[model samples]
Target: MEFKLEEFTLGPSIDTLKKCKKADLVVIAESFDVDVPVNINKQGLMELLIDKLTEKGLFKEPAPAVEAELGALAGTPAPLQALPTQTGMSAEELKLTLRIREVEVRNRELEVEAMHLRLKAIEMERGAAVAASPSATQSPSQSPHDSFDVSRHIALVPPFRESEVDSYFNAFERIAATLKWPKNVWSLLLQCKLVGKAQEVCTSLSIEDSLKYDVIKATVLRAYQLVPEAYRQKFRKCEKTATQTYGEFAREKGALFDKWCQACKVETFDGLRELLLMEEFKNQLPDKIVIYLNEQKVVTIADAAVLADEFTLTHVSVFSSPVRREPVSTDRRVRSPNGARRNVTASASARETRECFYCHEQGHLIGACPTLKRKGQIKQTKTPAPINLIQIQPLSDKSTKVVESKKAQIDSVFRPFISDGSCSIVGNEKSVPITILRDTGAMQSLIRGSVLPFSAQSYCGTDVLVWGVKMSVIRAPLHLVQIRSQFVSGEFQIAVRPELP
Candidate 1:
């Protein structure tokens, strides 16, 4: 179709180009001599084509409506002949031209709308600027130095504490920043919230010093003894309170430690701060845990704390109660002389029939035997079995003679047969089955030294009296054991008696 140069110069709108497929857009860009890459997508090709066309002056500024201009030119006289000749276009070219004109008109309308939006934004910004200006809010006669009523805002500040001067100041600074309170008046505002010793310190300051917030703060902190040494002490002694969560306690401890470092001016040096923290942390731990951390050669406070926590967890688990065991049967089975098994109610019938070993009496155990008490008062003439002697060496010949004489006297006293039971001692690697004697007269449990494993380290020395003879014994640490169908765990004294069967 034939077209005027003016028609071709007016390029297609972005919307029209967007409606075309990637291949069609590429073809159009090639016609306009735009350098569009072969791999470019439809939208990218369209943008490149429009930019190239505009740079080359192919897209002209849109004129007034083409339909009105054409109608005005086409008079009633020879209108049909003048329309094609004057425009120099066919029906199809005229339709294409009219479509291009329509697109340009729409683009102009969008540009005008955007301009109006930009103007609105600028006006809104100016309004906001005016609203925020102090001059706009205040009357001409009002001075800029007028005092803000901070007393009304005193509720926003947390109450000052004599013990927590640092914490109170931190909270007050944050509240002041939020309220936009002048720095010069911060001391005045803070004074309203002070009480007790804090208020006294503020009042004692000179008027000039009181007006200076930093001066007032320093004086108050000094009065409360919140110095570097105080912070160090607080950090060292910090303990988790019952009501505080673990996270909260950890944060509080960290804050105190930071304060100590800052006050001492060692915060810039990590090595010094870490050393101080590690020492303080070690002091709070048990001696054993501290030793373990030292053995691990921990370099940082965090690593030491982690190791200590792991050790604590493992230690606690060792003492914690084992899973709930099913109730054990109190009933016992007795093998009669005829080789027949007979069920015995050990908890009821057996207890009623049982006799005390000391008195050979029913309804009571040897612990409460009346005859046993009399035996302690009335010396027995019967010779007792040779007692196991775990004696400590006497310092002198006279003391040695006295110990021998005491042993001879104890040999004459009557000794009673004690009840015994069998149980296994569980260790990290293996279990050792050992027989345990239940001495009703003795106040503590005792075991043979031979029964304990060589690896066992818990040894507490004490003198135990068996019958009338006093013997030295080593107390072993707590151990878990399987006693019949149930687990038993506790500490036991180790008596070094190889002579006993």
Candidate 2:
């Protein structure tokens, strides 16, 4: 749409109309920024504008060729024949088709990739049947894992989904890395054998012997759990048998441990002896020859609790009883049929030599080392500021010199206070502190009191009233009755009822 801008000057009236026609008016059409009102019938304004434009001869007039084209558009070309390709088959159209083909090819590729990923996931779940061979290259069909008839493989653990296995494998891989074992756990194929090897490996590791033992123990247990059910019992039994008590086998090997214990230089060798008595340690023992020669009584719960609170020996819990499951009588009764008499070694070859933390170690507690101790070396001693100390004087000491002067002030302040004689004071081993009331005005003396021991308040009514109040037989006459403080805790007395004034 094109526009022209027009400017005009208007005359005032009919008299100036003649001049308006003769006036110089610049007229040009200009485009106006207008949006047609939507959701309303603005077609009426358009119709009126069209008529105006037609009267002004500014409406577009159809050329003969345009009229012919419009007539042809009304009916000439068949729908199929009028398709885009009918226009001489342009290269742009061919390019669009090729682009569509590319999209289809990409979709097919994605489908294939999706299948491959799916298969990989299945392998991870069921434990990937990886084709690892001594040869540089091996076919997937000939893979050791594939040849591993999963049916033949013992089911050590319950079956899990692909995703679950994937998650487990991820964690397994991480632990395997730190333990620095070969990355591929083909041992998983030989689950029981793998666990057995794990125990050996952990035992063999030179670094952090205790920690290594724990790792190997944990790893072996975990691996055992993953073995097929057929292999599990056999594996456990064999593994456990392999880990048989030292008392059963390796008698000669026991000698070395005994020698080592001697060098440890334990104070009494009592603690070391008790350690040998442990079933687990015995099972792992070098031999039966190393039975505890002299053992001390094992620590009790109280002892273990103290140990835990003071140190980080978390293997034992103080709160629970130390479990000593004595192997049943059957094992003991099943002795050698030959009935050969065994000679008791005359004495232990142990001599206290090297210092262990438990024995001669200085400056450090058992299980704690100097390297681990945190240091805060700056030490300063400062005298403590005085505290607000208050001391009570004996009730007998009327002239007690109070360390704090406020005591004298308090005594003077309470001097005028009158008593209604309704309270009592009681004492255990100590006498009750008394404040004497001075009301010397009346002929009858007034006494106000509460029971010395609140607990004996009932007794004041019963025991005291019956017996009458007595202070070492210096009984005051039937005096004013103070229901509150009648009992002198030191004396057994009955309350004296006095006549009301």
Candidate 3:
């Protein structure tokens, strides 16, 4: 179905205008007698004709592509594709298909770019969080060259002692290098703070502004110089037991020897192994075991330590078996064959006749006697004397007068601060008397729940000090109430530890 160039004088219908291609639009423009650019592109020509046809009220805008697809699917030919001939229709269809595919590819590219950006944002957030964490920040905060404070750093470093002087000097030398202090002042500073006998050699110099670091160091070291015999004597004297582990004993002996070497300026490893081995064998094991090792000639402390541990475990097992053994009663009420009970009291009496040599008492041997321990404890001076609340124990009738006089003397000379008080506790039903001690050195307050008439399980080996003597106490929870007076009170919580003494 073809049409002539001069088919209609007025512009074509809206449907015909919508269906016309750029070539058809250019032909229509020429037919309408309107001036068109000689070099105008197809798209420009199409737009110009659409404007001219719309100005003349002969055409309307085409429907969207989606509506066009729906219209085509419903068996109606779209307005934009209503041309009779199909010569350039395939090219237009190909261009529209390529444009839609290009749009889909562009959307996919945008989505991938957005995903990458989101992942980067998440990584950046995690990095920031890790940097903000305490563990991650700790190392950076500890950069010595940046935040070093000499007095503060040295304050944490303990005081120099003879035993640890070598390590101390080595560490301080590094710190001095970092601080950029003069090398000449190093030994002089150390000499001034000398811990042991090293100071004795540098005493009373009387020289001002002329003492050299090397000279001071040499003099102190000379004083520390000792012979191999001295080292042997000191090392051999050291001992360890099953109660003390090999590590602890080694540390103690090492410190002692180090101190000795520092004082003598004498570092000798001679006979050291023999001394340590012998000491370990003698002290860690029993006498019989020590003799056996001496016969075998054990040379290493490690071997001796192992043998000693085995011996200790064996002895413990042997001793513990007796407790598990059933006690056999020596009762003399056994029935004889003639139906008469024969008394075995004489045999029991003869067995009980053994006496303790230490206490000279009957009915017990020296090994099983309890009196020897009491005697030794009485002689020991390490035990702290109990502080007496009252000086004298008077008769009942005269006790009041003596107490009054003692109280007067106490009030006048030695006034004691009483810690016990009665206060109402929060979350409790009644006011109770509590012993409150003011320990200025303590980090937290404690209370005894046993004083509250409640069940508080004991935590054994929980040590505390009472009147300067170390004692064990039990832990519990305490609801504290501070009473300023009879009318005013304040409630608070505190950790409770029972039986302060």
TM-score of each: 0.28, 0.13, 0.22
Candidate 2 Cα misplacement greater than 4 A, ranges: 1-70, 73-501
Taken over the whole model, the C-alpha lDDT of each candidate is 0.58, 0.34, 0.51
In the range 1-501, model 3's lDDT, one tens digit per residue, is: 354333322224545655666667765775555679989887777777768867854453332553355334333444554423334557678568546644543554464455556657878999989888965557753533333343444443336677654456567667767867556555545555676676666674444322566566556544654333345466667877423567998997997677545544444464455555455446534455665665655556666667766666777643222332344435444353324454432233433665678889887556456888777778983532222221211113435566455445544333443233454444455655443434445444455554443322222213322232245332334344433324335654444444444
| Candidate 2 displacement at residue 114 in angstroms | 39
* Per-residue C-alpha lDDT of model 1 across residues 1-501, encoded as one tens digit per residue: 332222222334455555667777665654455687767776777788778877854454333345444334332121232222335567787678777656754554464455556657878999999888966677887633356776577678788777677878888999889888888778777888789988887888888797788898888878888876688789978987534567998999999888877665564578676767776777666567877997897758999988988998888743232334443335455454334554633333434566899789996557457888788757754332323322222123345566455444443332232222343443344444333333445443444545544233332323443343543333233333333312344434344443343
139-231 per-residue lDDT for model 2 (tens digits): 555634454444443343233233243233435445545645432233442233333344455455454443332354445544434322222
Instruction: Give the true-structure RMSD of model 3.
Output: 27.3
* Count: clashes, candidate 2: 43
lDDT of 1: 0.58
Kindly report which residue stretches of model 1 are placed more than 4 angstroms away from their true locations once superposed: 1-145, 239-252, 265-267, 270-501
**TM-score of model 1 vs. true structure:** 0.28
C-alpha positional error of residue 8 in candidate 1 after TM-score superposition, expressed in Å: 57
The better-scoring model by lDDT among 1 and 2 is: 1
The predicted structure with the larger TM-score, 1 or 3, is 1
Cα RMSD, model 1: 30.7
